[model samples]
Target: MPADDGERGAAALAQMRAMTADICDVIPLTAEDDFRITTATMMIGNALLVDSRVTDLEYDRTPAHIARGGLDHFHVTLCIEGEMWFSSGRRDVMVRAGDICLLDMGPPNRTVLRGGGGRTHLRAIILQRAMLAPRLAHPDAATAILLPAQHPHARLLANHFAALMLPPAPEAGSAEVTIEAIADIAAAAAGGTADIAAGVERAERHLYLAVIKRRIADNLETDALTVDELCRHFQISRATLYRLFETDGGLAHYVREQRLNLAFRQLISPAARETRLIDMAVNMRFSSDSTFIRAFRRKFGLTPGELRELADRWLRETGAVPAIDTVLHQLARRRKS
Candidate 1:
């Protein structure tokens, strides 16, 4: 049966916490406002399909949380609407509508869904690691990346998730096939073998792109980083480099976005308060302070100074973190609008 926060009224948050305690820790970012969430789960064989619509929320899997919640499965989340920022220690990627991302349950990671709008709808298929591990060439390099939902294999998975919500749902036997297809697509996306032979090639290409991205991040601060340098370093042709980053608006755009994101984080750090804005810009390899400020505002809806002030205010107000039980209990007692 699907558990839901609807009709729980003041008890919604606690109910939500109870429902997901074994999966991940859910924290409402805008605790000052009503936290809304609706979830439906369907079991197919050994896998689970979870469809959820949520407002502003942050899902965290810290070492402490993982100790309490066993991590034995993986979640391949398909974004049906809205966007989320997902970060594993090594990478940060935005998953938006028509995008799919792999979240390794074993890793300590975080996902932030922005608010101030309608709920974000997502379909997460959870399967045990053993289900896909054997098929992967590099299983350890599989998580924290986005795969285009429009791709043939990914499209099949997306279509299946959509069909699961329609009237007169798939039969039990057919549901099993759907589950298999989802697993195959996920495996292929994560550099694993699948029923489709072409998936092997696609998986290798995806893995290659992951390596390229890591290399780019390593040299982001270098002013001379360019497509030519990347090609030489990776021993790949320029065409391959362009194709790999085409979805991100080319390598240059992706690099700039990454640099800007890093600068934004640094600007809000307590220790970075005394650092000059120009110094931050230069460190990111931005040509000038004005250019960096313009790019920052375009990427994050705020100037560096505004973000710093907001972070300071937020830190002062939040002080010490309360226990999860305490927070949920308080939230459960609050009246809902």
Candidate 2:
């Protein structure tokens, strides 16, 4: 349900607003019809995916009742940063942050997201039922109702998704990979085995690595950060550091890629419009502009000027931009799938 600009975009926004309004109303009323569950009393981020709306709904819970929708989308609610009780026809569950529940769209179901002085905030990702139907062919899909709050994969997906939604990007070049892995996890949640692997502890370690990688991105301009230095800063052992970057060709190679990505962003950002190439290279912690140019070309198959020109041309082509973004997002999702 993606649309073009002007009236189409406005109409889409209005539709999403109305859908969220109904969702909010259904969340707190005692599973009844006359409650007129009006007003979202919440915010629905990611509103651009108008065909798909993700909303936050919270209020005092009364008696539980079945909620129905005209739209054919399954609501996969991850108890992200909160507490909730969810029940399908055959399964009832209590969820915390890191936990997830899939509300079956085709069946009668009930859920009460707890919220009060002692209760925490509840958040969930709502997926269109049709968008989810393709993956539900597996018999195990229904059993794979909710991911636990402490499961490593669940935590990883939650943290990565939040970071992608946040301002600063992760420092690691493999962030795209991490994000893909998260999407894969989401897909798996929609269809994989119900029981999480026993290696949840190990997955937790990878989440730590993700946070560390973000820290590295933040310190990209600081030339003094070395393997030993980073180890000391993070209180991680040298062996652990090596393991964290093992999939990315170890610490040095990983760091180089981080620098390169930042350099690429800088080469095209407004900040670099007035800066000299040599100065920009140095500011990105590159040793020399010549080396930077060589590396950039080797990685991107284009010189800085060429790449900038390409980027500018892309900006001028409005129709192509959204297509590119969609392709990139799909590729990222496929990687995890």
Computed on alpha carbons, the lDDT of every model, listed in order, comes to 0.71, 0.53
Clashing pairs in 1: none
**Measured by TM-score, how close is model 1 to the native structure?**
0.53
User: Per-residue lDDT of 1-337 in model 1, one digit per residue for the tens?
Assistant: 5656643233777787787787678888655247777889888788888898888789887887777756767888899888888887787789888888887777688989974487788889888888866756677777875787566445545655666554422111255655655666677667765444465545435544555565566566785568888777656689988887898898889889888866766765676879999998988988899999999887666678876776676568887333434433443464241
Worst 10 residues of 2 by lDDT: 46-55
Q: What local lDDT score does residue 267 receive in model 2, on the 0 to 100 scale?
A: 57
TM-score of candidate 2 against the unseen true structure: 0.49
Model 1 lDDT vs. the true structure? 0.71
**Candidate 2 per-residue C-alpha lDDT over 50-124 given as tens digits, one digit per residue, 9 for 90 to 100:** 111222233221222124345344555555444666665467667776676565544444556444323344444
